[model samples]
Target: MTERETTYEAPQGEGRDRQPAGQASPAERSVGDSVFHRHERAVDEVPDQPAVIAPGEKYQLSSAGRRWRIGEIFKLLRKYEVWNDITPVRLRCLLEELGPIFVKMGQILANRSEILPQRFCDELRKLRTDVDPVPYTIVRDCLHAEYRRPLSEVFSWIDEEPLGSASLAQVHRARLVTGEDVAVKVQRPGAQQVMAQDIDIMRSIVRLASHFVQTDQFVDLHDVVEELWESFREETNFIMEARNLDDFYEFHLGTKGISCPRPYMKLCTEHVVVMDYVDGVSISDPDALIDAGYSLKQLGSRIVEDYSTQVLDDGFFHADPHAGNIIVKDGVVYFIDLGMVGRMSNHDRLIVKDIIYSVAEGDVPKLKDSLLRFAVSRGDSGALDHAAFLSDLDYIVADFAGLDLKDLDIGEFLTSLVNLARKNDVELPSVVTMFARGMVTLEGLLSEYMPHVNMIQIIRSHIANEKSTYKRLEDGARELSVESLRAARGTLEAAEHIGLATRMLTRGQLKVNTQIMGSEEVLRHVGGIVDRMSMSIVIAGLFIGSSVVYYAKIEPVIFGIPVIGFLGYASALILALGLGREIWRNGHARK
Candidate 1:
């Protein structure tokens, strides 16, 4: 066999095992504990970070929150007369009153400009990231602890006045001793403690809301909070942020024309990042670029292309692509805030590319499967109504045409999509929402400058190129065969699982009366798999036999039909019919 063919078979032997080959017994430590340990280590390494007082805080919260029972909450709402505002204003006000966790929630909701109703999102977007900047003394002390040196020794001059202050960190302009102008980002003192408390509050909110509210038509609050926690945790790690900066800079390969602030390796710490700062006019001021002798259309088009390439091409993106994050400096777009980024594995990237391609081609079935793959986490056992998903997809895809892609309200589509999934109890990946958010933001940015640009055409071209590249890599027959074998192995494992179900049923492991319907569904699914596999085997057998016969110069007829041609066709059809009949009967009988 050729090297490619030999390499293809390398994974074939191991593919049958769902776990790694020669699986070991489960370790005493769980993955959750390992993750927690890492978090603890990171926290311990940060100097002068305040200890979290969970018990005291919990007591205070329980005592305070008890006053706002269901009746009281409703009474307050009525007294404020805020029930008439469907504009998300009332919700914003509530979040403000609830404290930092709710503020963080508002930020996350704002990021989902696509998945949220525009009016609601528009209102929530107004929730500023501004918080009380940590006292200058606290900031100085934290910096001193991080560097273990006098602040003046490194920086010739440091601005006490912050350029901007957000909930987590604040930025200040400074000059290094070597005369390099830079920006220093200092984490707020006791920030980690604040985050822990805020997270606890968020968890409590989700728990309470899930128990009391009618949000079955949207994402379950608990799961959304879990996703939010992961996002926030990832963002809070400065090491991760440093890596994000480096990774995107390397991935972009300089053609992106966007600049990342270079991290000063020696000066960086868990709570502080010193980096070269680029001065620019904010993207929010559309007129500023024009006055600076730059074409708005050119700038907007570049933003769209850069974002498309990052997502569809590189599979890593700045999850937050809002205008405030983009700065026009020396005619180049500078991407700031490296904390939040999204990364997709190659497999995920290919699947997403297929999804985008299917959407562009108006392939309803393919689009539905792609969306399911995009939404449903691996090993999810929940019932997904593929037919219903396809129906909704048909409406969206059909409507996507005719309108200028830039003008198409993706925000509206995502709201509908999220609603549909929520209604069916389908859990979508938070990263997918992040993707949608980034794309929507890019489109919104483009609209500010190049209003007439056809975004659909732009996205279509990007997807086409991505698909072409994928096809090129997958064109090798050996690679194709390997993928086929891997798929077969997966099918076989599923079959074994079905056999286990049968064994469990025989052993009375299942609750007979309560599980009758579920059992029937499982049987139908297994039977369908069996039928398809049988048909495939038979068809392959006939084709191979017929090919051998033709090669051997066999007789022209077989049972009064032309040998190898008509007989093979007839045999294949019979096999398909048998399988189809078996599948149909199994479904009917099970029901």
Candidate 2:
């Protein structure tokens, strides 16, 4: 659901290259990132570090997962070796050659222009996920393998050419014997195996990179990659995707202004899927949509409501709602590629609804408590600085606070809140992050359709309508009564305990007991300090010892330096720097 600029004029596009800071690009205006980039300079000739793979020692690099043999590596490298210069385009080409996993990574990077250099993002955007379709004969073999019959028995006329080709599969237009036009998705031969091997290669890279990088934070590199792998696994399962499509299609069958394609469960298998053929227009193309005589405002309103209902009301949402995954068909928005979806329990949906209501009401303390409820806390959560949290929330909500009700943006507020949550010891599910990002993409998608629609007003209207629903009224009353009874029972128990304590004090029958307990918090702090000190001393000793060894001019010298001594010195240098930084942070905190 991450946003990527499709064309030059869309809200989130290459306008960063031309727009000044005062007159920001539509993307930066919509969302702010501190490290955002501008591809203002000519970039085709800009030099970049070529990604090289030197086959290292077997024990460290050549594990069971890394099946990249020496010959295969060299062959892949040679394809891009034009005068030994590996340009960004060549890098993208190499990723394509490597496999679909790498291409998926490239597509992800193409959207992170803020984190990555603009030149790299531009070239990686050209990394094609859609490749040449597998031969028709091979496709026929796959279909036959799935059905154990000749293709002629099912399809009256299957086009020799694929209608669309993607990383894992290709779609072919066909007519079933029943005279129904259908799209058949055939998995590429050995696509699963290739992706598995690529994931192995990625794991090795992450392992090596973590040693030299500070990768510990709210997100872990390995976990992130594994999550991506899980997503890919879901997408590769055609049967699961067919089920998802069916669920969505059924959910919105009678809904106006939007729909999902129908899936044929009978024709689905692990490798192939049959669904209704939708010859649709890219939602990114505004002129065509306008020429079709569809009101952009009406379409945009429907799109926003569809997603809000999925997330806030239904709690079952399309996790990836980027422009490419959506299409315009006969004045209705048709959603495709239902491999990845997000679902929340009724309780989670209630918490999210409360959060939105809190924001709308400008109740910062209530919002903080509602958000903190989802966060995991130890003994010190009550000790959380309420003032600090309130300040942060106020800053986050400033855009919408005291605004003309018609101009507020609930999506931006949600995105900001999610990003702010991670740094403050607030633990949230990945699906929440995905939902927030999907909202951001939804905004960019609808900007072309309707520039003036206020999402906050829509959210408010939805909540008001929900409050008046009979089901909600019954639920609210039941919950309130239950909570009140629990509170009263707890109060009576506390009064009884106090009466017993008073009686014991009057009779002098309560024995006084006292013991000093070491605080786990303080002990942990001291232990961390001692650990840093020990590491610092060890690193210093290593540096001094290595210096002595080097001065003695010992054996195994390389480039006029002892190899072992050089290694020790490098290790000590990194550790000493880290120690210094840690000390500085602690000292600064004390001040």
Candidate 3:
């Protein structure tokens, strides 16, 4: 409602923004036209233009995007490379300068096959969240704004330089007035607004891509963007992350040597998070960990086992456990950054357990069966060559067959297996993919930390724990209980039916007619009579209403005639034609 704000309504057909008259919109041109007509109608409403910055010119500040201008950003990128690269390199560069929302969007875009080219994705995968820190004055100002007090009153001393900088927030080391050292994560000013705007852009991107691309086999592109939006919202809210840390710590409480950061939640807010400061070498640095007398092999196994417990045992696990998010100090592993987490239900956990079991056991037939059963889409089971798939799966797990753990790359192996599954028209869940990616990330860190670490043994041990005899017995008992109830109910129902049949036969009152709808003709005429009578009355009303309106000359006329009267006449005409068509169809049926 503000005069300063701008809105862009999509131009209808024949408008400048519409596609050329003969050209079909995305829905009309989609591979599966039978997908849905409503989808086509919706897609046709969008302006036939992508908002991406075009080559050889600065980005156009469209009405919807006019709130923020990036002419300076585009100018800076033009220094290293021209605008015509047709690569995501420039886009990635621009996103880095634009801040957190753009950075998150770039990260999400890496997986969007429908909207982004693979090459662009390849370049974007290299994008990192190592942004520059704001000045100490800004941090001080933020603290003042949040607490409504001076920084000196809250903190005894705070570091001017940030410990590390990321897309949404930057971390700083500080000491509380009470003398406890803590890490302060300060959210960028106006970050929520920027994130909201970028999510709106992402929605537009996904909707546009859905019109033309086929991403239905695994995940819906729009749904993925929506998930990312929700994730962004959670990540931005520091209070939510504090709760995650607390919950994760509670889940692993009393477990030997495994830990997550403890939050001082009273001092936390939507914009700032304060947690106990932890001093440890990054897990990626194996030399430091080894020099500090920590066992790399033990660390690797313990971490994987912990995640395994989180996934199968607890049904909740950190989704993002990259090397950067993990730390090792004095033989203890600490998981950090609890923004993105994944949760599974008991049923999903069972499916994952079977998957891990089959893969670790290297049982090709069992693996194939589990994959087919667990996949989100089991496409054309009959069309799949089960023997060939099993053979291929055997080759895929050939590395896992032996216990030479150092040479085996578990992450790559799992990815290949999932890729093979996809090729065979088996689509797995998002959690499955996330789990594999997390494993791959851990594998890289483990390999770097301890080249000879036997992760296979650890993973197998944890999986064995998941597939314990007690769990099997419990599951069997549960199934048996349900089956017994169902069978008992069936027996009782059968006896009742038998008793009724006996009474009917004894009384000589049993009657049966095998033919379905024996009275179809009479019912059909009766229904037809009712339908025609209603249609006739409605049509007559329409005609009479139109005549009355035309004679009365109602106000707000269209083309020298009342619009309502014209609509009434059009409705009557349509109904009469429909009636005539129905009669003709019925006559043909009779003939």
Q: Count the backbone clashes (under 3 Å) in each candidate.
A: 0, 0, 1
Better of 1 and 3 by TM-score: 1
lDDT of 1: 0.65
Candidate 2 TM-score versus the reference: 0.65
Q: After aligning candidate 2 to the native by TM-score, how far in Å is the CA of 111 from where it should be?
A: 8.5
lDDT at 256 for candidate 1? 49
In model 1, the Cα lDDT at residue 464 comes to 60
Q: lDDT per residue, candidate 2, 342-401, as tens digits?
A: 887787787888887787678888788888876655123635555666788888766667
What's the TM-score of every candidate structure?
0.64, 0.65, 0.61
Better of 2 and 3 by TM-score: 2
Error of 3 at 242 (Å): 0.2
RMSD of 1: 23.7
- Of candidate 3, the 10-residue stretch with the lowest lDDT total is 3-12
Candidate lDDT (C-alpha), each = 0.65, 0.70, 0.70
